[model samples]
Target: MFATPAYAQAAGAAAPTGGMSFLIQMVPLIAIFVIFYFLLIRPQQQRMKKHRAMIDAARKGDQVVTGGGLVGKVTKVDDAFVEVEIAANVRVKVVKATLSDITPAGGARPAND
Candidate 1:
């Protein structure tokens, strides 16, 4: 005669009610999303806004560096494109968004110096 004990303790416990349980389980996930928005998304959006402002302020005669690493003087600016003169009589058309940085009013020093 094998007298095995029946594990009936858990069977008598009632199931958790669904009303507040669902909301309670989701609290951590919602908190994580809020944290990510503040730490990651908000900063990225701010950077984008700053970059857009810089791009919008670009003008002819400004020295700018392209995303491709070319430094040139802005010769022309259109709605979506810019013309840059990398060397005397050597110019190229590039997208406005492709510009990464614009030098301040003072000209940049030559790399050799």
Candidate 2:
């Protein structure tokens, strides 16, 4: 006759449901953005602001190290450019932004006032 068992249960159970499912789903996405800002964006902005302030404060006669690895004494400073003397009687004009560091006063020849 091929008759089966006495009773059978339902095929399968449904997924669990909750009232705040949408809000819970957004947590990981928001967390990733926060992590990215702290790990990447914040440091970069701070570095740029520091570099801008350093560039703005450049002046003549300060010993400066350039982005190109050249160290020179500043001979002149303009709004957007600087003149560096790398050797006696030899000088080069460079962008102010190219200077990476200005030697602190009293540690080297004072910057022209």
Candidate No. with top TM-score: 1
Model 1 over residues 1-113: C-alpha lDDT tens digits?
89997875657667688779889999999999999999999999998888887888888899999999999999999999999999999999999998999864566633421
Clashes of each: 0, 0
lDDT of 1: 0.88
Compared with the true structure, what per-residue lDDT tens digits does model 2 show for residues 1-113?
89877877776877556857876888999999999999999989998897798788777767889999989888888998999999999999988888888885445644442
Model 1 RMSD vs true structure: 5.9
Among these predictions, the greatest lDDT belongs to 1
lDDT, candidate 1, at 107 = 68
Q: Look at candidate 2 and tell me the lDDT of residue 46.
A: 90
